[model samples]
Target: MSNPGSYPLPDRFDAVLAEQDAEGYRCRFAPVALSDLPDRDVLVEVRYSSLNYKDALAVTGRGKIIRQSPMVLGIDLAGRVVSSGSSRFRPGDAVVVTGQGLSETEWGGYSPWQRVRAESLIPLPPAFSLAQAMGIGTAGVTAMLSVMALERYGLAPTPRPMVVTGAGGGVGSMAVALLARLGYPVAAVTGRAALHDYLTQLGARQVLDRSALAQASPALGNERWAGGIDSVGGKTLAYLLAHTAAHGAVAACGLAGGADLPVTVFPFILRSVGLLGISSSSTPAAAQTQVWRRLARDLPASVVDSISRVEPLSRIFELAEEILAGGVRGRIILDVRA
Candidate 1:
């Protein structure tokens, strides 16, 4: 990558600007001045970003993701540090910024440049390109955090297969790959039958239909899995809790299905099952760095390449709708320069 400062620096640049008014949330491409960016310790010349489900919601007004008016609408960005007031970073250093209230309290990656707190930046791994870092993005980071949490609870590869719910989505897909890459047998659950082959290709030893899981599961009936990673909350999570083996752990990340957990205490009291909740948004910098290091070691290049696709920023509007409807798969990397 060329030094960004080499070009005649423009006072303004292109950005996907969002604002909330009486008419509701609206977003579009617009020229925003450098001064319009958030007041922070570091300025990044963003090269790549990703379209996450939360970012989609923030961009489309489908969810209350951005509380402030005129916010940028991307949750993750990867690029070179243009400048930094803090000692942690300097010009030309590759870095990544995700979550940390992005697209909410702070201006985010949906621009040519972003000003963010130096504490929020993660030094990009040498093995990954800016696009590849965004390929992992927030969802992959969350998956890794869940994996770390599960391991913290002593979950490991064994004779019994681990189940990954919502296996077609970003976090679930990455979880399946990471678990399988670590030599664990994975049973992936998805509503879409079309993705069974895809999941298997990503390293799932078994592909179970979402409906079959419900039918086969009961209140403490057959403890099939050693442990599990669940993104779908509601009944799916409840089912996982009920069916996990005695002393087994389940890492619950997202509530894509629904927030309601209509479950009893049998899994906990009778089976000694553990439920670990994973929240990556506000994870401390040290922990974030730890997970990113783990990710660099665990998530192989082949798996990342298989699970991510690149698209230009112009396509985000349509991709957002597709992702919200659960029509998209894996990760979607945005080429901010394109």
Candidate 2:
């Protein structure tokens, strides 16, 4: 094990902690001692973490994202190793950790310092800096995973166009950019009309109002798209399934809209539409590596910068409210070290 004294380790660091009290659940930025962290194989000095829908939900107490109390509350982090017990990593190694039950069952990334299992960390790809890696973060990984699922199902780029729901959010924005960069026409769907121009700037060929697909979808509607990456579940997912072209596939990654599936199996029986579920939190290590590699190759840093902004970790609560209110346009990177 590397000597922790070799690094300029802080006795205490700031983190966003969520806990349930006699009063109620509360999330706040507080100082945490290094010893308070779990006894994991690697001690990381987190440089950047990104705000995701899940993080917002947890911080705002809107969703039961934190299964454990006194939990750190950021799902994605990019940083450098300060000390390591495993041979796979040494002090000063750059790494990224996303999902793997972060902010839920395990302590997560909303801290300047955190102890993580070595297996949960991925060496930062040479294509991205620590900040850039967080910019892609959990959301990018989910979007890439969705695209890979669609491709594995034999869906390809074509003139039929691919739809991305919740297009103003992190995953949807990344999906729009990824699909468009892969030569597929992208129709970005958002509830906020103000984000139309922003979505287009992220490579959306067309931007549609959320109401276009948020209504009560029939069992089978006209084939409007070849396929899609859906982050909004419920009506939006139902609509995608109902209108997807024959043999098309829809990758469902989130339920920001709602969780219920209101449509029947007509789309599946009549059109052979495949609904692929993407659970990014528990994706295997090998698949996570593949997703990162694909993201490095396909997602340009410039586009990432255009769609993302950096904010201090102190503003996490305000940002969480903004995200939940559907006011945030793209990804928000938390400068943990700030």
Candidate 3:
């Protein structure tokens, strides 16, 4: 429970939507009744939300991200607790919720209020404000998990160059910045040469063309990459696989290129290279807790300005279209109340 002034509930809200239109997706707002929200242990007055690639897919119907229509469509949020039915959280607690069906099977965080399962929420780390958390959001969490996986599996070693593909995109950019900040020499690969300066500013020692990695060939070709954080799957993933150094690993998350991983097993068999699957959406509870803590501490505070674009809730639909077209850089944060 919360006092009125501290965590008073939102009385009304306008839920943002990507309506199906004759031309394509149209940005619109629809009135929502707070009573219509799903039953959950916590009611959050969402102060901040952010956009993801999945959100774009959902809005454009390029892919089916939302299982239900006329659904609210932000996948990540951070805010103060307005109401709590669980002992873990009380009114006034600052918390975050990510990747539990978010913009898919249930209501998400694109509105002024959100209902979430208590177990799915984590206390906002003391090191970052709620806005900072959303700036990192799912993209930051994914990057941390990938980096940690490389370390745990012995794929990462000091003095070896780590590579990040899709270096201009959210997960990729965050991974590059995070790795470089931690003293690893980073080779960033991206389609846009214009972002070369941007990637280098984030600590990438070198930036490569997307075609430099290309697609992998049968068996293997080059002994490169200590290990890699890859957000573009398909051929790009295969390229990393074929070229990863002996005993190197590639931690893969997004399917932006394609879901089909067309690759030869030579890297896995001969080089002992490993392809690690990082599924942030359904990561186990214990692991989820560990990764966020890492993000709060290991990731630098300067990263937010380099990798974040802020927007009002009203602009999500237009932004979604741009992101899907590969025109977006870094992360997009949504100010739900703005």
Clashing pairs in 3: none
Best by lDDT: 2
What's each prediction's TM-score?
0.96, 0.96, 0.93
The ten-residue window of minimal lDDT in model 1 covers 1-10
lDDT of 2 by residue, 153-199 (tens): 99999899899999999999999999999999999998888887888
Model 1 residue 331 lDDT score:
92
- Tens-digit per-residue lDDT, 6-86, candidate 3: 334555668876565466555467778878678988888888998889877876677767666557777788988888899
Q: Give lDDT per model, in order.
A: 0.87, 0.89, 0.82
Worst lDDT run of 10 residues, candidate 3, spans: 1-10
Report how far residue 146 has shifted in candidate 2, in Å: 0.3
TM-score of 1: 0.96
Query: Regarding TM-score, does 1 or 3 come out ahead?
Result: 1
State the local distance difference test value for candidate 3. 0.82
